[model samples]
Target: MKDINYSEVNGYLFPNLKGREEVKVNSYFAQMKLKYLKTNEQGHLFSLMAKNELSTYLEQVEKEANEMYERLVEEFKVKWNVTEKLKERDQMEWVQQMNNIDNVVKEIILKELICN
Candidate 1:
């Protein structure tokens, strides 16, 4: 498979999936395949490039998921700081939220990076 480039923005990047902010990214790649990857003049999409590009796009999606998870952790910390001083119960809730985020990020990162 051909390698595709990944772009990052604001320390966050989304995958070039069918939907999401990367719609333009996906469309641009589709057009690239239609123009350059097609075997004929019929503007048909090229399977190889499409597959490679989609995989690269998915990598971006995974990156975004991880970043979102980190953001959630930060949010949880801020919320916990505010509530912890008032109620001890808030600390347990904060820990639970952190654990959840950690599990999600681990699964996604492993799938995107190590397993691949």
Candidate 2:
């Protein structure tokens, strides 16, 4: 049997454990989707498992999110005129613009890939 770790909370020990179906979901998108599934859609997640497509589904979502992020960054850079020249002229402006783009992309990913 696998070992279970415990956490002591106020002199009480509680088993720090997860379920047997431990799918390895990496990347921000995959993690978000996994959390959503575990919290709100266990039946769907288990259905995917029974169909032998959970990994593939997560992988595809991760890939699509990553690709969308990259593409959005490139597009936003061009659209917002965030270029090497701007970066060289003002480092703060470059950073702010990049951060904005990142936030927008993450919002898009959350709505399109994760929440839904």
Q: Model 1: runs farther than 4 Å from truth?
A: 1-51, 82-94, 100-116
lDDT for model 1 comes to 0.49
Candidate 1 minimal-lDDT segment of 10 residues: 20-29
Across residues 37-65, which tens digit of lDDT does each residue of candidate 1 receive?
23453222234334445445445554565
Prediction RMSDs, each to the true structure: 17.4, 10.1
- Residue 46, model 1, lDDT: 34
Query: What is the lDDT for 12 in model 1?
Result: 81
Query: What value does the lDDT take at residue 30 in candidate 1?
Result: 34
Whole-model lDDT per candidate:
0.49, 0.89
- Pick the TM-score winner: 2
Cα error of candidate 1 at position 67, Å: 1.4
